[model samples]
Structure formats: C-alpha cells, structure tokens
Target: MSEEGLEYLFKVMVVGHSNAGKTSIIQRYTKDNFSADYKTTIGVDFFMKKIIWNEDADILLQLWDLGGQDRFTNLSRAYYQQAVGAIVVFDCTSEASLLHSKEWKADIDAKVTWNGKKIPTVLFANKIDLGAGSFMKDREIIEECCRECGFIGWFETSAKDNKGIDGGMMFLISKIMELGGHAAQGEAAPTNDSTITIRPRPKKVEADNKPCC
Candidate 1:
C-alpha cells in the first residue's frame, strides 16, 4: 500500500520474544505467505497495508516489526515512537515467551504514546499449530495479564495456517479508529473497561520469574 492518499494512517508495532512468530504473522498478513525458516528481525522492519473502510474511506496501516531479543530491548523505545496500536505476540509452546508478554507491554507503556494516550494493544499467542499446552495451562494467568497490561484482548493464532490474524488485526484497527486515529487527538482517550484490569499477577507466575540469561 502506497502512502499517497488515504483517509487515515496508523503506525502499529508488532512486539514479542525472539522466535515467537512475530515475523511469521507479519509475512502472512502483508504478503499472504509464510516461511518455515525465518531470520530474526534486526533492529526494526516496516510494512504497510490498505484497509478499505468503506466506499469513500481508505486506511493505510504502517506496521513496524520490532526485534524481540532482549539485546534489542533498549532499541525498542525508539522503534515504538508514534505507534498508535500494538500487537504483542508470544509462542504458545514456550512459557518464557508467554511470561515476557507483560514486559513487552510494559515497555510500550513506559515509552510511546499517541497524543499522550495509551495506545490500543492486543496479544497474540502464536504457533498454536505446534500445540497450546502452555497456553492452556496458563489461560487464567494470560487473561489476568491482558487486563494488567491493558490489552484489549488476546487471540490464539497460527501464522502458518493464517488463522485468527485478520480478525485480531481488524479488532485493533477498529479500536484505533474508535480512538479517532490522528483526527481526534484532542479528545481524551477513554479507558477500555471490557478488558482485564491491571493487578497483581497470579502467585504461580510470580514464583516463576527468573532473570534471563
């Protein structure tokens, strides 16, 4: 999608732990293709898509795929600039990846904002094709994490099969549009009461916290 003329333009970021399939979803969504083998995203990568809002309106979404390795964490704040929406991904099979989702969300809140407002964020539990053992076990904790981090919702996704990507993405887009995109920057951003509220995570998860090596 060329950035020529569009009714609305939004900058969105995709963030998650390394190998959690963040790039896989980007490739699947933007190019309609997926690769079994992929390189880790360095620094940042950008992609854009045009959404036909209606007959008269067109929305161009600018996507920044931020590298998720801990080494790249310091660079994330800069990459997150001007992002009005976020898609936080984690591997369904990896407990570490799932736990790190909160950290990723916290980093975003600590850094960027559009018009001094918390941007809409959603979580993606990627790689469900392999299995969802971790996801299933931590379902309650994940729901609590979503609320604590202010995520609007979370979805189980498999980029390889292209499942749940579009639906989850559009939900985020609608939220951005509801927030009035760049147009209604003057209005105060409203709280999302439907989502989970920020609170102390479950004790089990708290017990599992360990410094990364």
Candidate 2:
C-alpha cells in the first residue's frame, strides 16, 4: 500500500556469464539468504521485490534471472523484453567473466528499449569477499570497460555477505526512475516484440573452466 496511491512496477533483468552469481544476488536480495550449493539456471527464472522509494512511491521490481550457459543463450532475448533496467553482473575473481560481461551488455542493448531509448544499466562486480584475485584488478581497466559498455555505474558486491547489495539496487532503481520516466507514464514494452532477435555468443573452444563467482 502506498501513501500517495501510486504504484510503479519495473522489469529488471540480471544477466552475466555462467556462474557469475546472478541467482545468488537475487536470492540474497529478495530473501536475504545465500546458499553455498551451486545450481545452474535452466533458461530463465523470475523473482519479485517491493520497495518504497522516496517514502512515497511503491516500486515493484520484477527481476528476471537469465541462464548464462551458452546453450541457453538463444533464449535470452525473450527474457530481456520489456526490461526497463538491468544489472549486468560479473565475478570479481575471474577476468574471463568480466570480459564476457560486455557480451551480456551487448545482448541487452540489442533487445531492450523504453520509449525509443536504451534502458538504464548497472554493472555488479560480485564476490568481492574473495579479496581481489581477479585478472582485471586495476580500477582504470574496469572503468574503461564500463564506459565501453555504456554502464551508468558499477558496484563491488558480495551476495554471500550481503554487502553493497541493497545500496547497489537502490542506485539502479533511482537511475531507472530518473531515466525511464516514460515507462511509468504508460504500459511497459510488450512481452513479445517482433523486432527482437536472439543473438548468442560464439561458442568457446575451452570447456571445464571453473564457474565464475
């Protein structure tokens, strides 16, 4: 229930390379719990959370967790439909995962739009609790990558520790509200868009790589 009788619902997608802790972030955020066990997402999963923004508007965020496995990549674009914002996640300990983050961002950019505008996007460098063994350790490189991918901002987070999760989400939501104001003015993008094309990344030659954070 909102005091001003205004309710806003936003569809937000969480995407990244395989095992970048997309599901874990959502679990920690929506349920405040984390699990050590690993389970690969099949295609896509949905979760919902509500927040009161600026103490007046009620925000319902529909989080779509898209599967990161290469086989499932062909199905990702459909999940991206109608997304007003996105959080592109990557593991802090793996440089490969960080590099793959751009692919995820490109996928999103190719599919999602609000009122003829690109959706707001943020980057999450997850698993910061692992304490800096990442290949791209330099902040300059990370900032350069974010800039190249057109990310509004980036956050270092640990879903297992619940560090920076809430703040990051709030920041993303604020930006979405600010930049995607037209989404609130009318119904969001349709669930199905004929123009969207599912573009999967090229198959990697290596297998048996360790899962990302």
Candidate 3:
C-alpha cells in the first residue's frame, strides 16, 4: 500500500473531432460543472485533479484538452509527448466525427509512446443525450473501430448529463496505473517540471450548426 499522502502524477490527453465535447468532459471531471455555450478550443488547455485508488494510492491526473481544429492539429505531436493515456471522443450525432476518430487514433499511435510502446487509450462516444438520431446506431461498428484503432476500451458518454464520465476516467486510469511502473510504498511519484498556463479561446458569435469534423 502507498503511504498516507504519496501522489502519482499522470498526464492524460483528450483528443477528438472539433466540438465533440472533449473540453466539456475535462470540465465535468475537474470542476463538476458543464456549460452548453463553450467555444471551440483554440490550442490546448489543461486541468489537474486528484483521485484516491484502492483506498491507498493517490493519483494526480493532469487532463490535457487538445484543440480539435485542423489548424491546431500540427501542434498535437508536441502535446502528445510523454502522455500516459488518452481519451478519443466523437460526436454520436455526426458520422463524420465518428469516422474522424480513426484519424485521431492514428495520430496518437504515431506520436505518443512510453518506453517505445503505444500509450493506453479509450474511445468516448459523446453526445449520447441527443438520443436515437445518431448516425452510427450499431455498437458493432464502434467495436470494430476500437479493435482496429487499438483502443483498450470504449464508453458511450454524455458529458452534458455527466453519464459514464467518471467510470470511463477511472477505467482508463486503472489501465494506466497497471501499465505504468508503480512507485514504491513510500516513494514519491515524478513531478511535472514544465509549467502550464491555460489561455481562454475566443468565443464565436454564432454556433456552427454543421458537424465540425
């Protein structure tokens, strides 16, 4: 068992097609709040949260939200560096967004690595609250995608309603902890040396009705 206050820090990145609720997931997990009027993420934003696992270990999760715009994709490689796990989100209402999930997975597989191995990843089907009108209705399709894309697991999430959010995060973190080297009972987890400051992205006057992916 870990000591009373020892903490393990892990960097987890959230990537997906634009406006697929990646930022909202981070916000819901970190702040326990959600807004319907969030703007498109411009570059990258991050927040930190602590979780106690198995009543012993402390996990400091640094959640990184990557901007989903095409222009920002060039910067993804930099953000992906040293990431321990990832959540690839897609809009359930948009087929394009779901298709683009493969692209995002490819991008992650190409860049982020730990000890020359692919980082752990989970696929999130966001916007499930929209209900019954989603483009991809079949679970088999998503399963096939996960199999081909190398995801450890997948979740049907509604960040707007906070459904499946915590469970998905906990599942991913468990996988990360298993794959990542564990610290000794009284040892300290490595610290993140780089300082990160999140800058607000400009909000658009009108929301885009078209699917962003």
Candidate 4:
C-alpha cells in the first residue's frame, strides 16, 4: 500500500493532552504492540520510518513523540515550529482530554502565526476499541473542538486493536508529500487544502501619499 514515484522527506509532530493514547499509537505504529498498562511519556521521544515512493527517494518520517504533560506542553511548541506535519491525538474515553485539543491547537498557533494554514494535521480519536458511549462522546467533543480550532483532518482509531492506525499515519504522511509538492512549486503552501487557505495582502506604503505642492 505504497504510492508510486515519490521521493520526499518530512517531519511530523505527535501531540495531544495527557493520557490521550499518544504513546500507544506510536508503539502500535512503530512496534506493532499496545499495552493497557503503558507508561506516560516523560519529556519527548521520537521514532523514524522511511516511506518509499517508487523506490526512488525515501521520505523519512521523523515522528516527534511529544509528552502530554501540562508542564511539557509549552516546551513542545518548539518542536511544532518547524514540523512539516502533526498528529493531534485524543483519548476516546476522556471528555476532558478531548476538550484540551483546543489548547494544543492554540499552542501551535501561538508559536506560528499563519492564517488558514492547514499544517498537515491528523486528529486521532484513539481508544475506539472501547466501543460507543464514553468513546463516541469523547470523539464528538473532539470533533467539535477541531471544527472550532480549524484542524485539517481526523481519523478514529483503536491502537489496542490496531484499527485505523496505519491508515491514519499514511494519510498524514501522504499529505506531507502533497505539501512538499506545493512547497516545491513555490506557491503559498495551504495550511490544509480542505481546511486552511492562504491569500495575498495588498502592498502598503510606509508614508502617506501627498500631492505634489
């Protein structure tokens, strides 16, 4: 399930509020394993995966496994500053975690000021294996927050059951490739073609125009 004739590399940041199954997704994606008793990320961790496009250039995914702790959220902004893509994760069982998605978006916005910029984000409503009720409720809350905060896209996943995890990662990485194209074309890269927009501004003159006197 790989794309043909593609050679590019990009950085992706994994971010979310604490206990949002951020680590679980990473583990499942990178190592194909999930644990019910997984430990929280202390500071920040990272993993790399090489995606081949037509077997030409290798697009390396530098996944920044960000810590969800409140103290580390502010510190993680630096990681997002230059990230080509991001995965905003959330736990399907925690309404509070879903609510905090806005705060995560705000932190990124504060670090980087660009209007209607998509920034290649994949919102993951993790732990979907728990089925409905609390899980669906959390998903609904996060979806609303994404709408208000302008997230690009989303996917529901259950890292425990390995549902939608690979697809979500590939979807995000594929978008990174698309953005790489926009960047190569010298066009204003869309924050997200579906979500963010980029428009030109009129030129301004420092001094007020005056009639010849």
Instruction: Please give the lDDT score at residue 90 for candidate 4.
Output: 81
Looking at model 3, the pairs that clash are none
Q: For residues 1-213, write the lDDT of model 1, one tens digit per residue.
A: 233323566789999989999889999998999998989988888998878875545677888988877434566666776677899999988888878998888888877765556789999999889988645675888899898889999999999999999999999988887766435433344344222111111112233568889
Better of 1 and 3 by TM-score: 3
C-alpha local distance difference test of each model: 0.78, 0.79, 0.79, 0.69
| Predicted candidate 3 versus true structure: per-residue lDDT over 129-166, tens digit per residue | 98734447777888999999999999989888999999
Count of clashing residue pairs in every prediction: 2, 0, 0, 4
Q: What residue runs in model 2 are displaced by over 4 Å at the alpha carbon?
A: 1-4, 70-72, 134-136, 182-213
Point out the worst 10-residue segment of candidate 3 by lDDT: 195-204
| Ordered list by lDDT, greatest first | 3, 2, 1, 4
Between candidates 1 and 4, name the one with more favorable TM-score: 1
**Once superposed on the true structure, which residue ranges of model 1 sit more than 4 Å away at CA?**
1-6, 70-74, 181-213
lDDT of 2 by residue, 40-77 (tens): 88788899997867544667788998888742456666
User: lDDT value for candidate 1?
Assistant: 0.78
lDDT of 4 by residue, 1-213 (tens): 223234344667788988888888888888888888988888888887766554434566778887887434466655665576778888777767777777777766655533345476778888878864454654456567667887777888998899998888888777666656655444865463224322212223345778779
